[model samples]
Target: MKTIEIQIEDYITNDKDLISVIKRVIKDKKKILLQAPMGTGKSSLILDYLSKEFNILMAIPNTAQIETIEKRNGIFCLYGDKQQKGYRSETTVVSTPDRLLQATECFKTKNIDCLIVDESHELYTTANYRPKFKNIMTLQSTLKNTSILHMSATPQANLTCLKGFYDIFIKIDSKKKLKTSIDIYDMELNPSNIKNIINKYKTNNNNTFIYFDDKSMNEELAEELNLINVNADNKKNNEILSEIKAKNKINENIIFTSVIRAGIDILNEKNAVLIICAKSNLTTDDTIQLIGRFRNNLSKTVIIKNFKNEDTEKNNQSYEQILNQKKKYLKSINDDIKRWEENKIKYTKEDCTEIKKKLTELIEIFIELNEKGEKIEENHRYKINTHRVEISAYSQLQKNKTKNIDNMIKLLEKTEAIKIENIEKKDLNKKANKSFNKKIQEKSTEKRELKNKELKQRIEYLSNNLSTLQLELFMEGSTLKTLEMTLEKGQREDRELRDALRKTLSVVEPKSKYYKTIQQIKKYITNDIRDAFKYITQRELSTCKKDIIQEQIIRNNISWIKDKNVEIATDIIKNKIIFIRHFKILQILDNYGLIKNSSRISKKILKKIEDILIKEKYFDGIKKKNYQKIIMQDLELIFNLSRNNKEIRISSIKTKNMNIENKKQTA
Candidate 1:
């Protein structure tokens, strides 16, 4: 293979020479390997210029990049599960490698003139360690007929594999240097350390991006610092990037993982990068790619931990040694499979089943090892004596010392590539402790105030509603009592009047005019007395029904009040209150007139209540089993219920009715 170096400035000013070289390589039907620093217009050269000349199929690293490239260049892009139809008909199409692998049949039907693998280093660095490496190898085999162009800022691949097809290797060295100074803090990254760094940066009013590999930790830190976190799962990444690029004054800092490391550009001059490197899996190349995301050539600050992983450095093995082990493992598995095949006839059914399970496990391991070995041979054949293709930043930095970083960081003191400082542990502790204590106090005060406010509001709501319900119940009780007393008094008077009339009729009905007049008066008095008794009896019955309905309303209101209080209760007391309130409510409802006569509350009723509570935004995060248990236990206590297996025996309690007619007749 021939190697050529071109100045990026010269190519940008007059790219006829580089274009001529690409043309010559194309004429010779040789694949091209283009290496250039990030933010030097690699994607632009392909999509804007190269596509106009030749039919190109650019394979991006991710869907976000695919969308970004499509939107910026107005090209046909395909990715994800749903791909655009007839993408092969377009002269220039962009897609992810996985999407390309999935659409192998479509590509085989049409000709892809030249395949550009953007960020192609991922083939060895990322996919080599995963199951998808096999798919990538298959993709390489499937597209072997097409001319390939591999491009990246930090390129690492199997030179032996490419030597057969890729004859020309071009490296673009940029004349312009980044105006970013890196500060290497020799400390571990914890919540406290991170907060101190963020607070320091925040004091300067500079926007910051903190990079951490753990998504959960990133989110926790983001929440603690009140910053937006962007990751692979965050759907608003594009919007966040757009806001940052547009210089919108939003959050002073943002937290991110590896999702935005490459293929995305943030052209903000005032932005600073803070990378937490303790116990991380990021390579030096990845770190550079992350720093390169800020495209502007203005002076900026970059902070990273000077973390060194001694174990990774000490345990490093040569690629050849690892490859030999994998090959040996594969050979052993193959031998085992051969032996199993030969002796299978002698094995019983049970033995065969066990053997089949073992064989299946071994086969999966064999496939993984075989694919890994192929990838190693293709990507790391030339680097047999070196460590694995992707070296951790800690190992890489330790190996290279502080003088040079593969010509990437350069480690020049004048350029401030690596700034090492002796940060005092006591000072950091003091500052972190002070900040932490202050935060704790602030949060405590805030929480206390919030709790009080919430408690006050809940009390106000429940008290006001409860008071109204209690007053209604009181009024109904008082009215019912008054009606009963008045009915009794009227009945007594009616009885007295009827008795006197009867006596008068008995004594004077047989006589002349005087006796007849007494009889007439007696009859009138008896009829009047009867009418009054009937009216009082009817009124008493109506009052009794109203009182029953009113009592039910009061019970519902009380239950509702308890439910509302559950929200304001402390965590330590929440479940206890829930159990007590839920139990009481269920007991009342089981025997209440709303449900038909049943000793035990049915699951249908429980579920209905649950649905109502859920709709009302109650019982959040409570387990369904716990809720059911509470209700069931209460029902058992109320109805003297017993359970035998799944069957429940609940003692029936007969409902009572008011015998108002009997009382009236007696009176």
Candidate 2:
């Protein structure tokens, strides 16, 4: 293989030399593999420069990339059920590998000068996990006559398969210095560590992006931090991206999984990247790809968790051994076919024909396996050749463990590309504790403010409803005296006013009408005074009880108790047997057959059973009689045990009776 290395700066400034190299390779009808660092303008070179001279058909790893390319370059991109007829009229057409493979018949008739495979590493890395890789294999063979250019930031595919296909390998190195600083933590990736990192970065008003492989963890951490999460399971990914791009990016932090690891650019500056690496999920290549998502050349910080790799040596098999295993499997399938043919009475002719057809396909695959060293395995009744690719890729990922990451960091440090920091376990814990304490203090302040607001509203209500005299007496802190004085004053005033009115109106209208009006006024005054006194007293009492409860909650360190209703709390505290801790005691009684039926067992026998359970540590502090009563009651409730005159007996009916009663009530 002919290898060439080019500086990215030179390629950007004067790309004539590299273009000449590619042109020569194309003239010779050879395949080329282009390796370059991400964010170094690999796509720009192809779409802007190469498309002008050559008819390019770019095969991306996914449809999302096609959309991104089309939006950026204003080129025609095809995927899904879109027609390929327009592909022939465009200078540069972008489509996914699967779609490209399906349109191979169309491509064979068109004048495609160069076929570019973007993110080509996925061809092997994700071959086993994704079904599209099968189509990729067919596309590779179908376009054997066309000039192919494979491009990736991390080309981790097995080169043995591409040895005969690709003749030239070009690696482009960036001349611009990396301004990102990476902090490596020698700890497990957990909620505590994630919280600590987010807080540290957010304190400086910097945006942060967290890359974790687990979808559930991504959603959980995003929710816990009150940030946006992007993953395959998220339905509003496009909307989330739009939100990130919109003005006022208040919640700037984001948590994403592997779905958008590549073929996406977050054009934000001063962003902090956090990669959560586990033994089973992320590898060195994945870490590199994650860091490449940030395009701006501003100073950034990256935090990663460093952990050891698991031993996968047992899974590694030699090529010859794999072939031998396949041979044995083939022999077994043949033997089954032979037996079916001999027993035609039991097996139909159609079954025999299907088996023979499958056998022929397996034999053809077996020959290809031997020729190209492709791995094969049976899925249901069909055989697939994608297994070896998965094994090879996994082994490569596993082999590059903690040491590989350390080496990559050391290389950057040696080149003066980044500043490296090691965060110790103690420091992480200290930060986590500080964050936890801050949250608690904030919650306490919030609750105090709510209580103060409630008290102010109550005071406003009282001031609005209370009379001048009553409010004055209440403010003087004399509750009983205020009620009494207000009542006496109302009675005295009422008597005087009624006397004056009667004397003034003595000669007017019927006296009975005036008497009814006077009685009504007296009754209204008396009732108003009484109701105000009652409202004031109850409000004061309720406020006092709330204060007492809040104080008790703080003193006992059971603040959660304040949220529960009084009735519910009382019920829970009074029911000693309904606790989950007593479940084991019930099981023990059941095991001893003592929970079934008992003629009120002698007090002595009950005590003996209690002693045995207590000795076995089942009953912590329960007494004998209480324990016996609890057991009997539970047995009756759950198993429908019957009690007749102080004698308990197991009823034939069980949980079915309770279920029937529940159904009847629901009906």
Candidate 3:
């Protein structure tokens, strides 16, 4: 083991206990606890003592003060910041517990000589400590000797209960006398009260630091002091830091800051007034920390707090009105109970116990949920979070109570002995009133009138769109050109020819098979609607091998060269993938236009084909129907997007839901 001399000449005075304990702890290698009130310069004394020989990593609670704390402590140390990524090489690292926990894996301090945890009371704040504690404790494995020095004015109870955590306790005395005065006020928590507090107490302008527990109200507080140039565009932290660093000793700078509490230290705040938002049961350590900004005896703290009323009325009603409603409800319930007792309702012991047991179980389940809720709500009183959990434990409890009452009533009515005629008669009498009968009659007439008006409007809308949607009941007598001029007209179509699918390519399976020949023919088309618009030409049909007819109507058919990218003629000849009711030559001509190479193509004809394909639900829809789905005057239009759909374009309709599975729209 190597020994080094500790030196801090004339740096610390009067606090002999602080100096003695540090020396003893380093010499003996034992865990020690230190408690020193704020403004005592305890941090400065220790940093100077350890900087000469040992590398110190000071765990700061306030991340905003990383630069200030390092400078005030008189130690040039690295902190957890974006620019300081190379912190691994730094001899002294100073940052908050949360920051250190994130970068713990980068630290290679084999047996740390000393670990100082600042704001040591946070060691047990479950939210503050849980994640960071796991990483901070890793120092125990890295430490060569000496103990972890936990420092705070008031150590939390959880850490103090741990056995063998600290061997010796040290309390440092501040040479400067403590002088602070606090004033409590029960002013309402509103903008008016805040303005008054600022006007009455803001002495020597902008020297006072204001803090609010609620973050949502912080913006409003800043607005109230907007004239001080504080409501600038700068962020809350940057604005406050610049104001504190300004040369003027706090005057006429409207800086609304939410900080100034906790482990933050402000050296320039001496003789400055402290306006705090405090609560009941204030601790001595907390008061010292809050007012510790000024080391001078002249500085004072004024607490302006208002008592919170959790049970305040929610509506614009008098107290008497609320009381009357509560009384009426209770009286009605009491009357029902009295009547039940008078009626002498009978029930088996087992049945009654079962009902009681079920009710108890419901109550226990609600209690369990509420217990979990409380654990989630556990947070620092000052740093509370805002959230909206729609259901409250009280509301849920009330609902459960109502359900239990209804269940009990139903069970009583079911029992043969418990005749509930008295309760039923009273409820029936309220419904049998003359005014109730008149109200029901009027409502029924209004509903019938509304329904009739809707039906008439629907009939008129359908009649208007009927000409646009032409339907054919019998295809044999249709006058459409495509159906009448087809070559399959004069010939008996061979029903059973060996129709074999030569090649197979399965990308996605359909949920239902629409065709028996191609068991699951799920087609995915990506080309433009106009590309597949080409019907077989008369000349091309003369040399065609076969035709595929759909629903006794002849659909187009054409031969397709299987592969387009063939280096040799043999490969091109071998791969012949033919599509039916779809002309490959027409699709090729349409796709060729996309390459910007063909100028001789007839665009007018291509557009006509494209319009026809759109009517078949090939592309997206608009307010207008696909013109191709319409003949000159005999268009059989299925207004819906799906193939073979029943929805006609004649009526005003609504899609309940359009579910898509693998890009297939299912309405």
Candidate 4:
């Protein structure tokens, strides 16, 4: 195997930890895990190591971002009928597992090398990751021979899921930065005040994103912002990057979104503020991911949190346990930072600032502990998460009442069974009456009438389309006339042959060869529809030898003057009728701008009609009917004046009856 070593410094600023892992993984030809918060230069770091011959598979959650990665790597994605052929030594970044699998197959067939999984955290989960791993295993020998790297900010709870391939792990600690300034603020304000702060910051900087927890809240906030003449759009993973680009081009300041957890890269912003709702419990993972959005940007981050204290009375023990775990976790993290600093490790100014912020947060937790009437141990590391403090405090206050409630329940249970039964009987009678009225109130004639009216409207729509088709057929002067003439002559020629088919069908002796031939022809026609539209000219009939043979067999099998003769004539006429039906449908589709490539408009029309016959049961049955019967039905139900009169009169009578009933009800 050939290799080219590259310096990671050019791609990342102070990414020493990441560099060490990559070098180790590549040297051992093993998979590596690179974890960092959002906005970190993860993509660029791996791209730097990639060469012209590198066979990479970079997966991201967003299609637009993946497209950008594809463009940057000079990769061409196949669309529609295009063949998958690599133009040169370019990398591929696909958004879906299936596409990635297909592309991996292409790489293996072409002897392409190297594999990289971006946002590898998503792959650790069973849903997508397991299938993706299975797909790559097909190319296991080749992939195992080449270098593979997985980069993500979050590792799945069980590392063994990825440990099969990734033996080395590297973590980029954003908290280690000294200049990564973080300021936490508790702001209690109404919607108007929140709007004021947003306007102030956006007026100062154009690149800003406001993330909400969900779509409903995002929509409410967006409507409020729009009223103030602020431009805002809801963020979809597919459109966020492009929307942001367009906003940047026009210098639009604000992006409102509910994508608080997804990794998004926003460049060139000086400052950002996050407004958190107080009455919600967002997880630690969620909070860290949201904060990570501001990490890589050289901007000071301010978190405008609305922290509502919780009532811990009911869940005090559980809350205390969780609080203790958080303290231990934070203490360990702080101690690690302290060790790095004392050893004069290669620390940036951002690293020192993050340590100070952690210290201040830890101090605030200790202050809360004292206020909660809990004793603090001297020199013991005091630490806690916000949720835990709220729970424990509530528990202490509710202890006395909980005991009293238990005593009350015990006394209630000792009451006489007969006396309690009488009270329950009266309650049940009252509840039954309430339930009966609720059921009766819901069964309204008006609601039933409305539903029936909608169904009738749909039936009328189908009937109208059927009628219009008959009218068009009758009024035809050019195309329909030509079709009718050819069809009539064909039916005359097939008259005798069709008669023989019925005679044979009726006489149906158990071992008759004629019956077998007819069955075979029917089966052949069923399969021949797929290739029937490919016939362009009489010269191409030889190419459609199977359909031609089946057509001939059906024509020659008729042995009677009436029954079998009529069957053959009908089959021939039906074929021509289908062609006419297809031509009419194509014209409609063409007129509506549904058909492109009008040069091959005739072929496309035929194919679409064949497709409809195959897919729709009703149309298939209609097409298989005797042509004369089809024409008779078309005339009676559609073109005949008496049929139209009867339909109109029935509708009018029903409408008049409905009006009479409405008047009577109102009276």
lDDT of each: 0.50, 0.52, 0.39, 0.39
Per-residue lDDT, model 3, residue 161, is 36
Give the runs in model 2 whose Cα sits over 4 Å from its true position.
10-14, 81-88, 102-109, 158-164, 177-179, 235-238, 243-251, 275-279, 298-306, 309-382, 386-667
Q: Assess candidate 3 and give its TM-score to the true structure.
A: 0.41
Cα-based lDDT at residue 651, candidate 1? 31
The residue ranges of model 3 lying beyond 4 angstroms of the native Cα positions read 1-17, 69-78, 83-91, 99-110, 125-130, 138-144, 156-164, 203-206, 215-218, 221-240, 245-248, 252-257, 267-271, 279-287, 294-299, 308-667
* Positional deviation of residue 272's Cα in model 1 after best superposition, in angstroms: 2.3
TM-score of each predicted structure versus truth? 0.52, 0.52, 0.41, 0.38
Q: Which ranges of candidate 1 are over 4 A from the true structure?
A: 10-14, 83-88, 101-111, 127-136, 142-145, 158-165, 236-251, 297-316, 333-667
Kindly indicate the candidate among 1 and 2 with the higher lDDT. 2
Q: Which ten residues in a row have the lowest lDDT in candidate 2?
A: 559-568
After the best TM-score superposition of candidate 3, give how far the Cα of residue 368 lies from its true spot, in angstroms: 20
Error of 4 at 238 (Å): 12
Q: State each candidate's clash count.
A: 1, 0, 9, 30
RMSD of 3: 30.2
Tens digits of per-residue lDDT, candidate 4, 238-283, equal 3545544333322233434434244444443445444433223333
Question: How big is the positional error of residue 460 in model 3, measured in Å on the Cα after superposition?
Answer: 37
Supply the global lDDT for candidate 1: 0.50
The CA lDDT at 538 in model 1 is 25
